[model samples]
Target: MKYTREILSDVEGYVPGEQPKSPDVIKLNTNENPYPPSPKVIEAVQALPPSALRKYPDPLAVELRRACAARYGYDGEDWVIAGNGMDELLALAVRTFVDPGDAVLTTYPTYTLYETLVRLHGGRVVSVELDGAFQLAEAFYSTPARLCFLPRPNAPSGVCVPRAAVERLCAEFGGIVVIDEAYVDFAEVDGEAPPHCMDFPRRFENAIVMRTFSKSFSLAGARLGVAVARPEVIAEFLKTKDSYNLNAFTQAAGLAAFDDYAYMEANAATIRATRARLTNALRDMGFDVPASQSNFVLARWNGVPSARQIFRALKERAIFVRYFDAPRLDTALRISIGTDEEIDALLEALRAILG
Candidate 1:
């Protein structure tokens, strides 16, 4: 009676953070931008003509792609490919590059979706466990695989892999490397230039850098994402994408947001400030917090009130943060940087719960 492939029964799909229904709840599980998107984005969406919906959108999303390319200093639109979201582009990479039973590399305790996508495509996942500090293990370099999904400012941990390390991986790893830069916008920098791998696509043909509008651009609902690579690599991605993958409204909104890139920068600055404060506060409260470079922090609680108890207690109070039950993460709670007031409320709740 089962019509699906045998693999379907064994696969447990990626579980996203809880999205609460009530408006009053201080939802911080998902790493969404707490502030609104650029005003230009709102204006652009509103300005879309009703007739625009009557026809198909641009199959390649050229305008949006060009804008993204220009922003990143890419030579032309051929180097950029837009998608429904980063997730779609990720799936495309797997579909275009992987054959059934191929080995796909990913870091342990990283984004769970990477493993799910590889398994669903019948690819084997070779997960290299990160070091105690959450840095890439030495095995990551020598591991033989057809593709590698590495997130800069990695999810859950928010620790960015060193730029030199990435360069080494690209130079040595024989297969394609997809550097998922989903939270690169929030990465704190000591130097004038921000740390990023955007230039890798130009220097290394096997490197593909992916970005999402969901976290920094505040366009999660619009489902816009972009992939940057050598034109040859992008050509294969373009072949796999759906015709008209990006609708008219999303294209307009993403373009407007990209044009006003300063708006996103300003918002990112605010989140970084809030993240510092939250990190210090959590540390003061006895949680072992790593110096996070993303919009969220993973706080490991080792004291009287266990992380699970704190998560359950916070849930009862309608304040939500992320708690992973996986190994090395079981003792930690990942908290997204919310508004100043929202963070204040959370701190107050933790004080009450711990006492």
Candidate 2:
């Protein structure tokens, strides 16, 4: 039963942010989009033909790719590649262009999945730890990896590196830079931060920008995501992916989801507003709230009970949030910004826990 590779032998797999199944707990885990996707997503799927189940989905996902390009303000279908999720694309990206022994660097405390992907490929996973300020490590400027994984608003901390930093990497470096904009729409604290790489990566052939239907699009269940790159990279990824990785329903749903961007935009606005309220409230309650630019707040209770204690207390009250058991992040809780009512509920429960 040891068919697993050596990489699997000792390596701990990436833990997802968390997804509690209980209906009672206000699930503030797994940075999932709290709102439902566009109504068109529902309508499109409802009208999907059952006959599709009999045949395999389009291996290329041409139409869905086209819709993605259009959404990103691109000219044609050449810039986009669809995936079961951006996660699949991440794995494929490594296998496609990365050499078995090449170095793949990513920010520490980022989507850990990136590290797991590189390790599984027999590649060296070099992490440049974010300094105490939560910015890119100096290693990024001093030495660059052949590939890098970056979440635009980043993760857990939900802080973004400056655009100057990204441009500096793209200019001085010689490898493909992948920017994961999974939560960019929710990354603005007051509309004064970095721009989404998707909004401009077409200008740089070496830069690859990824977008997901999971967060802002609110289609986590649909599991659809797209990566935008120079036409050259798209062709390479096409050659690397499973011929039929995306199903027919996903294509229909993703297309419809784009058609109803306004619906998703409305929901994003609500999350932003609520995120601000919670950040401020947490600060008032003596927590060191990091400036969150995503639909979540990262807070460390000021000399209060440890993050583990707060996590357990909330669990008993049926409220779920993400707690990373790593070193600097040990005391911090990454709370997904939910609906106003959900935040209120969490606060009410917290009051009791601390008292």
Candidate 3:
């Protein structure tokens, strides 16, 4: 009586962070921007005419694509593509590059969605484990596969791999290399320049850098994402995208957010400052916290009041943080950087729970 494919039945699918409905809860699990989106975005959405919704949106999302290109230093719109979210674009990458039964590689303890997408596409998933410190292992560079998903400022751990190491992977890997820079906006920059792989698309034909408006731009609800690569590679990706993948409202909101890019930067700076305070506070409390370059930190508790106990205790108090039962992460709790007041509340909660 089962109508689905065997692969679909066997897959466990990706589990996203918990989304609590109550307004009383202090939510710090999903890593959403604690501040509101740019005022320009709000105005743009409100300004959308009723007529705009009467017809189909631009399938290519040209205006939004152009803005992204200019912002990221890409040559033109042809080098970029927009999607419902980075998740949709990621699905497109798997469909475009991986044939059934083909090998798709990724680093373990990375984003689980990558593995889920590859599995849904009937591709073999080859996972190379990150070392003890969450750095890329040598095997990640040499692994043979049709496609590789490398998330800089890697999820759960929030550690970033260096640009030189990324360049080496692109130069040597035989297949496509996707640098998932979902959290790159929060990483420390070098002077005026950001330390990211946005420029890789121009230098490496096989390199594609993907960005999301969810984290930095505060447009997660709008579901906007952009992919940058060589025009030839983008051309192939365009063929696989769904018709009118981006709606009129999302396009307008994303473009407006880009217009006020400074707003996003200022918010990111605030999050970075808060991240430092959160890390230090956890360390002072005897938690093993690795320095995070993203909007969240993984706090590993080694002694009394185990991570699981802390998570459940916090939930009972209506303060939520992320907890993973997976290997290497079992002892840790991933906490998102919330508002200063929210963080203060979490710290106060931890102190009470530990004592």
lDDT of 2 by residue, 211-262 (tens): 8888898888888889999898899989998889999999999999888888
lDDT for each residue of candidate 1 in 10-41, tens digit (9 for 90 to 100): 88988999888899999889998888999999
Error of 2 at 174 (Å): 2.4
Per-model TM-score on C-alpha atoms: 0.99, 0.96, 0.98
- Colliding pairs, model 3: none
Question: Model 1: residues >4 Å from true position, as ranges?
Answer: 191-193
Model 2: lowest-lDDT 10 consecutive positions: 187-196
User: By TM-score, how accurate is candidate 2?
Assistant: 0.96
* Per-residue lDDT of candidate 3, residues 179-222 (tens digit): 99999999985534359999898899999999999999999899
Q: Which of the predicted structures, 1 or 2, would earn the higher lDDT when compared with the native?
A: 1
- What ranges in model 3 sit over 4 Å off? 189-193
Judged by lDDT against the true structure, how good is candidate 2?
0.83
**Alpha-carbon shift of residue 38 in model 1 (angstroms):** 0.6
Off by over 4 Å in 2: 189-194
Cα miss at 142, model 1 (Å)?
A: 0.9
**Native-vs-model 1 lDDT?**
0.92
